[model samples]
Target: MNKGLYFWKTSRIPGKKQGIILAVLLAIILGSVSGWYYLVYIPHKKHDEEIQKKKADVANKIKKIDDFYEGQLKGGGIEQFTQLLNEIYQSRMILGLTSYDEKLITCKPDSCTFGYEILKSHVFNVQKKIFWGKEYSASFSNKGINFSGIPSNLKDNTTLTNYRKKRDVAAVDCGRLLNYIYAFNSISDKSDQIIIAKPPASSVLDVESEVKSQKKSYGLLFSTWSMNAKNDPIHIMSIFERQAFKESFIIKGMELKSKALKITGSFVCKSGK
Candidate 1:
């Protein structure tokens, strides 16, 4: 007999046995496929979904950061602050008031250099014949420019007395002036007081030299002299004193007069940080 023909004949099985064997093999394969789908594929699919959700969260956070930076760029950043300073300076110039030179202005994150000027006065005057007023004196406290002056011998001249009363009232009502002074000083560096000569006693020429000088520094002046009043010549003598300060200035340990007047002014220019 031939070898190949003998092996083929032995390998053949009966019909019923062959069908049963095939069915058992098919069942095993189907069970294995079902197990793989439930145990491996399902878990892997869920993990992939979680990863995608995390990626979406990260993307949203990055977008928010980008939007914030974009908004800052559109707001003009430091340029807006600089423009505010310029407007303030222009307003001062229009009012015939002194202001810091534009070229000299400097800004930082928390503070800026915008020039300021303050004029504070203490005046005492006496007239001999027309108004024989007794010695008058006034002093101010650190609390906020209070004026307390004593005037005497006003019973004979009601006009002079009335004028003196009016002057006194005006002097004490310096709330506006004090507001500006305190506002500027609060933002300044009170380094030193600048001293300059007092202006002339004449009404017309008094502030001429002082304004022209433009000292650009802070100073205080005290002077006393006898000068004829503009219209009256009753041999008047007056003592006048003034305290002035420039921008970026500070007062040495000065307190506010009342709690009602809070310091509300702020710098117009600031750094973009």
Candidate 2:
């Protein structure tokens, strides 16, 4: 054989073997890549998608709660109602109508006409009177403010008898009377321009005599009635008189003539000093 032919044959055999080895390595690399994509990468991608889905659900729930509160604020709920009450109170204070005044003003029926009208037309519901006493409670209703007066440990006493007599004499509905008392108390609580004198120790007759003797301007004589925790009738009397009376006179006038009488000098709202 020739030397050049022998050398070419030997080189060709090694080159074929090298090509087979390269092909096997390439196949192994491709198989590893395919296995990684199916087993590891695919499961990790699915887990990430689940995590994002859960986060979206939580965000949606939080948004729903926020919307509920926002609706309450805009729909004249408790917060709006409270704000309206504050405005009315401030307006009355500014106009010097903090207390109940029986006298009529030149411009309108009374100094608190605006407040009264607002209360009567919007806030005050006759049904709510059931909740005025200790045993009574109130709840909301579409028809109106519903109230239930639950009778507690009621007792038959002289004060209760006297209160019934007075109510009969005045010819006022029991519910209406309670409503008036509640309204008066509410207004009195919010008033800032009133002077309440201390109660007296004398009898009601003597107090009346002293008031008459003073010869000063007088206003409304407010009489309120309610029941105590023991279900006994409680009578409270408040005077809306002039501020000109001396402290001595007021103290004397605050005395109750009888045990059935209710008198508190703490609530004195004067119109003119």
Candidate 3:
């Protein structure tokens, strides 16, 4: 045998089993790394990102709330804000808006003639009321307006009832009574889930003539709407406060089996002599 050939023979070549073992070890390492990356690392990373994003969103909302109050002070107090909102809706300017009843954006002033026909027709007998005082053009709330529909604390109706009975009806200004309906609707438009079942026409409205001697009207309201929670359980308290905040409303009844709430209440829209 040649010297080189003798040396090669003495040196052991790895068997098939050894090669297979080495291959198996390599596969195990790669599998472990892939499993860790997909099962453990990826989920943790995604969860962290979600948490961070949620925090950012919450913070932004808080900042907006603070800014809303400060802006309200600068623009004028809540009473002025409320009155302006009522005026805007009453002008039928909101009707011309593309956003329409959503109340998200201030309506652009327009020359839409939808209601003109009603006013022009002689059959309608609409009386024009004029103010001799200075007419200031209407102002508007800040874009992204914040209306805090905070509910007032209430006892029983007896106290209010007694007070109204004792008080002279003639002392009340009818302007506030007319205004309350428009203002209340303005706030209610922003309530969640609660929506108009159908847009009722002028015929649906009950217009009562003023009594000659007393000259009083009590609780004039003509609106019908319905609500059912689509996804999560309804925020019952928040919805109630927003809807009922403008007036006195109570939960008249509820059917527990059907998870139904049957509520009937009237708003305060009293006008007196």
Candidate 4:
């Protein structure tokens, strides 16, 4: 009886050992799964979050570019175009388009050779407005705004036989206007304080030329300036008229009545944005 009992105990010991081995294997499998959840699963989730953030940033940049082009296409007349130009100018200024540092020095000193290329492009762009965009003729800059491009309602008005004379005057006026206003040094030297403080009159800034070709009427714009220039301290006078229509005029109460009307109507600055 004792011998039989010893054999049974020995067999039970081996079975108990097998059970312990199985328990150890089960614990390892659970630990591996938990580790995967923490390391692999959580890390992948974070990577997805980062990717989403990058996509959002790209979307915002694209939206801004789209809005800019849309505004350009709308033309919204000269005032709107000028306003857009001013915004771009201001952004470039803030971004240090001409320079790299906070000193506000031009790109020349900063070795940013790209500045020349950008400025050249911008100058040409603005000049195009003066030449062809809308209301004021290319001659307005030269021959005065009163010059008529098409002389008469007469069918055979061959008076344009001297088209050369007309063209010459238009060219001269355009050149003179550009010479007075398009000086790079002069523009750069002009105080930013003035640009920020004073804007031009509503009419000048928001100008429209009503062109009546037969029964159809269309509004066009040639050029636009900063309405803020209206309040500038600098005395600017048109070369042809010699009338101080900008900063000086406002200081002298020339626009008192207009100002009153604007204020009474709760006039909001259109280009404030």
Candidate 5:
């Protein structure tokens, strides 16, 4: 009986050491899983959400472009209307273009013009104004061209309340404004001349306002546009101004001013044109 007891003790499997090793392995696996969830899976989920949001935003912008054309056809067409279409075509090209030198591309001619004329008739006015010892060609930067023109008193206005909202407006406004500027710039480039102009002072008004109390004069419309470039994405920007006043609106000769505009990103274009 004693010999049997001694054999049993000697044969007892090394269960204590094996159990300890198994427990340690299980603990390690649980810790690794927890770390993966916190460091990788959660962040990946958040990144996907952000991407979806941006895609939605791009989709909405495309819809707005389509709607504008629909409305243009519904509205009657005059020579001015033709001019507007050309402007939009050019503007759209400028939308994807990334250059301060104004090399416009990425638009079909017809659509840009449609948008251009409508945008142009409402947003710019040229008047003689004294600023820093000179009379300059001036129009208002569209309310959409950032809050640069927003009066300090109106900083809290519904539109000027936030940078993101203002930036969005700038993008849209840039698209619309580029239409006219592109046409003009195209001509200027072909002729090898550069035209300098400035945004109108706060006081510029629609001449039609004086003719009839009930009728409203044309006003500036601001819009935003963005580019989806594979490498360097750009937000081509400009503010559109419309002045439907008499043809004598260009009385004030062109002047140049050096007010700094805030730019947030990069753009690439083919040429200086």
Candidate 6:
């Protein structure tokens, strides 16, 4: 079958009514165009804007990670980022916008260095709060610990320093013992000795330093007379976790007997895995 185009012819109308009809038709066309602008164009424009924003955020993250790889991102990016990477396979944080961990001695493109801390004072300062002072001295099973020798928050750089010049940094491994004191951890003036053992001289020996595959490790062991206070000494500080930090503060063993508490833990003090 063959098909042919058909045409329709209409008679001419008056110009006055034609203008009104033309105006209506023009209004409909404009309305349709405006509708398209509001619906499709506007939505796509907004979507593109969101995509660009996301791209910008991704670019910022990429730059940060690049800085970290290039060793331009200093601070604890090496240590803590490595730790996060280990966890995520490990994971973080666009190399962290800001790194607060201070033990990272040096961060380089090829290799990084971490400063070590003698945790004797780290644990001792926390111990002093529990055992020192007139309030706590009276509540000790022994003569009580005299904290006159060491001030609070003083970390030891005894073997780690050079020629009497100590590394003046509050190490990343600073809060080894303080992690146990949940209630009194952040407080500088620790007045309450009710929740923990006394300041009966606590110490953490640097068991080993970091090797190729091996990281620096520490062993913390201390014994103190039970506090002559109202609360059960060890019950409040329920520190039974294997590792309080990334690779540090591993709870090894704990003992309590006859108003005396002994705490033993492995603080594998290192940058990361």
- Report the lDDT tens digits of candidate 6 across residue range 1-273: 122322221233466679999999999999999999999999999999999997776565544433322221111221332232233110112112122111222222223222222233233111211211222221122212221221111121122222124223222333444444444344422323323344312122221221212322222222221122212323324322221343222222223333333333222221212
TM-score, candidate number 5: 0.28
- Give per-residue CA lDDT, model 4, range 129-215, as digits (tens): 111223322222221112123111111111122221222111112233334444532544342212222222233222121212211
Residue lDDT tens for model 2, 1-273: 589999989889988999999999999999999999999999999999999996775555444433432221111212222232343334334323322211111111111111112132344333212111222334544433322222211122222233334321122233443344455456653221233232211113233334443322122122222211110111011222322221111111111122222222122122221
lDDT for each residue of candidate 1 in 1-273, tens digit (9 for 90 to 100): 589988877776566688998999999999999999999999999999999997775555444433432221121112232233344334335322322111212223233222222234523222111111232222223322211221111122221232234321111112333454456446643321122122212221223234324311111111111111121111111101122322111111111222111111111111111
Candidates 1 and 3, the one with greater TM-score: 1
Residue 241 CA error for candidate 6 (Å)?
37
- Using all chains and alpha carbons, the TM-scores for the candidates as numbered come to 0.28, 0.32, 0.26, 0.30, 0.28, 0.25
- Off-target runs (Cα >4 Å) in candidate 6 are 1-13, 72-273
Off by over 4 Å in 3: 2-10, 15-20, 75-273
Model 5 misses residue 103 by how many Å? 53
Total backbone collisions for each predicted model: 2, 3, 0, 10, 33, 2
CA error at residue 98 for candidate 5, angstroms: 63
List of clashing residue pairs for candidate 6:
88-91, 131-199
Angstrom error of the Cα, residue 215, model 5: value is: 33
lDDT at position 3, candidate 3: 89
Top candidate when judged by lDDT against the true structure: 3
Error of 2 at 91 (Å): 2.9
lDDT string for model 5 (137-162, tens) is 32333321211111111112212222
RMSD for each model, in Å, please?
A: 26.3, 25.5, 22.2, 24.8, 22.2, 22.2
Q: Model 4 misses residue 256 by how many Å?
A: 23
Q: Using TM-score, rank the candidates from best to worst.
A: 2, 4, 5, 1, 3, 6
Task: List the candidate 1 regions with Cα displacement exceeding 4 Å.
Answer: 1-13, 80-273
Top model number, TM-score: 2
Q: In model 6, what lDDT does residue 70 have? A: 24
State model 3's lDDT. Answer: 0.34
Q: Write the per-residue lDDT of candidate 3 for residues 11-114, one digit (tens) a residue.
A: 64556668899999999999999999999999999999999997776565444433432221122112222332344334334332322222222111111011
